[model samples]
Target: MAQVLFLGGLGRSGTTLVERLLGELPGICALGEVVHLWQRDLRDDERCGCGSRFSGCTFWQRVGERAFGGWANVDVDRVHTLRDGVERTRHIPRLASAAQPAAQVREYASYYSRVYAAAAEVSGAKLVVDSSKHSALAHVLRAAGDIDLRVVHVVRDARGVAYSWTKRVARPETDGADEMTRYSPGRSALLWNAHNAAFGLLARRGVPVRRIRYEEFLADPRAAIIRLADFAGLAPRPEDLEFLRPGYADLRVGHSAAGNPMRFTVGRLPLRHDDAWMRALPPAQRRLVGAMCGPMLRAYGYPLNPQEAR
Candidate 1:
């Protein structure tokens, strides 16, 4: 009877921060981005936020050992290649089928059940955090049955997410060696629109869900954490906030040469907001974002256009 929490949203949203915060709660293990299903490989190139290679890192080693009965020796490059293939096709149904077993999908559900059990046992918590951010996976997990699951639909302003992606594209040398693609404002807005639409669809179908705004969480960390904890059936505690400070440095994973500047182990509760998107995006990009994501923006209580701000 393990509780499984699916934390999802479009990439570059505050899902990472939310994962870390949730990991601090009693008996919870936050597994960051275990999106690789067919390939179990972690290489020097793929840097997990935990400061370790996803495959060889001690943290994941223990997780694999506990969950899969042994470390399946993941290959970093192969997993990346498979991920690239999935992206190139833009076929979510195919990707979902790829994660399923031959005869029946029951085996797939069993695999996830074991994973959740192992994670909960190892973390000494009743819950596991799966931050894969794919709507298809969410659907598959729900259809698989027997897992008590809840979804946290995290959302951010489309312009803000686009601005962050711009920085990621620019800092390819620093962030990682991978040749990340730059997202046009139109594409970014569409991505946000699609992801939010998926979230809404699943939520309407009776999936237990809570929607959290990234900007609002930054504006009030304590209240936000408490609300999220409540939604996840967790009791709020002081240590959770203590572990959320910037630069506190405890969860480093791999043996990478360069440390993440954005990595803060602990510092102050509720980090400051980055409003650079308001100025960083050109007028044309801003309009594109607004125009593409207008419906979702309005659904989330954001202004549809700059003119509507006043």
Candidate 2:
């Protein structure tokens, strides 16, 4: 059976870096945000982590051929639509419910299992890191009986997450198309709660889950990697972390489908906390983020106020 490290949490919570770190480990293959593989990578023609177009990459081509015979028969638009409609936050309750109809759910999950099985076979690695960052999708993938899935729920301070989303970071994958995302602090806070809460429910429902705080991991990545490795049933040598540098690891290119432009980071990974929000974010937004996410923040051991967060 193929094992999967399914990354479930809000984006910008350090999942990409974590995924890259895990991918660099021996016997682990990081298939970047496989959720975005169909639409962003295949249909939108985004760049893979190795800097090749999706269809142009030999590794992905092989995976496709092995998983689904060929890419021509896979309808990107249709698959993307089906995935989004069935696995967004709004659809979580139904998908997780035992009483709900699941004909389509089974179909989508079957697609994921085949892809994951093919990835494991092609990479010759026992572990696959999928940083899709959606709890609902994580639920679907875990429901697939054939794949042994472990969830890594990454969390950051809600205010930091909200601040990160407010910035206009360019999507390097899209070239000159001006791809970027911005969300209001209120929206980010609410979604953060919803996503994390859903992941918690999944854990309570008996899925193997290990929650990693971004700040904690940044403080001691080696220990963090070891703990995560143990959770995922892998053994790491001292040299498995040899890629670690002062700030960032010397990460290699992966066949990631979609994620932050950091997916393309080749050399040094600066292990710096993004606290610029403390100085840059307005008071109202900070308060809004805290207020919207206060209960969950307290539950997750974060200070109620951003000013109090270290």
Best by lDDT: 2
Clashes per candidate (backbone, < 3 Å): 19, 2
lDDT of all predictions, in order shown?
0.64, 0.85
TM, every model? 0.78, 0.96
The per-residue C-alpha lDDT of model 2 at residue 276 equals: 83
lDDT of 2 by residue, 215-309 (tens): 88998888888899999999999988899866778887788878888888887778887788888889999988888888999999998766777
Task: Give the per-residue Cα lDDT of candidate 1 at 16.
Answer: 71
Give model 1's TM-score versus the native structure. 0.78
Error of 2 at 290 (Å): 0.5
